[model samples]
Target: MYISYKPLWHTLIERNMRKEDLRLAAGLTTNMIANMGKGKHISMETLTKICETLNCDISDVIELERE
Candidate 1:
């Protein structure tokens, strides 16, 4: 299974938040954000930070895909 982050784009749109704003609010570095954009696996702690920052659930950010 692969994880997708397409929902994050939607969430950003719904929240009217920019990627840079999310990075700042989540205390994430550009490289980390870039990695996430590339669908790289991130730590649970980082995921939690993102969820908290965006006031969203994990399902609002990541998705599971069958390969």
Candidate 2:
């Protein structure tokens, strides 16, 4: 299985937040956002930051998916 950021995109939409906004609020680099866009693996620390900034749980940001 692979990790998917699909839930993150939905959460962003529900919050009316742009990727740039999330990057700034979460103190994330542009490259990190880019990697997420590509569904690439990111560190748990990064996920923690995102969850904290968005006031969401990890499952709200990512999910395991079958290949």
Candidate 3:
């Protein structure tokens, strides 16, 4: 199965936050953001940082790919 961050993208839009804003707010590197954009894997530590910054649960940002 794959993971999708479409929820996270929608949440960012709802929050009026740019990807750059999330990067800075979450203390993430550009490479990390790029990875997320490409639906690539990142560490849970990075995921936790994003969740904390957005005040959201992991499920709010990620979902399993229906295959």
- Model 1 whole-model lDDT (C-alpha atoms): 0.92
- Name every residue pair that clashes in candidate 3: none
Q: How many angstroms is residue 58 displaced in model 1 relative to the true structure, after the best TM-score fit? A: 0.7
Candidate 1 deviation (Cα RMSD)? 0.8
| Model 3 per-residue lDDT tens digits across residues 1-67 | 8999999999999999999999999999999999999999989999899999999999989999976
Q: Each candidate's lDDT (Cα)?
A: 0.92, 0.98, 0.94
RMSD of each: 0.8, 0.4, 0.7
Per lDDT, the best of the predicted structures is: 2
Q: Once superposed on the true structure, which residue ranges of model 3 sit more than 4 Å away at CA?
A: none
Q: What overall lDDT, based on C-alpha atoms, would model 3 receive against the true structure? A: 0.94
Q: Which stretches of candidate 2 lie over 4 Å from their true place?
A: none
Model 3 residue 37 CA deviation in Å: 0.6
Q: Where does the lowest 10-residue lDDT sum fall in candidate 1?
A: 31-40
lDDT of each residue in 7-28, candidate 2, tens digit only: 9999999999999999999999
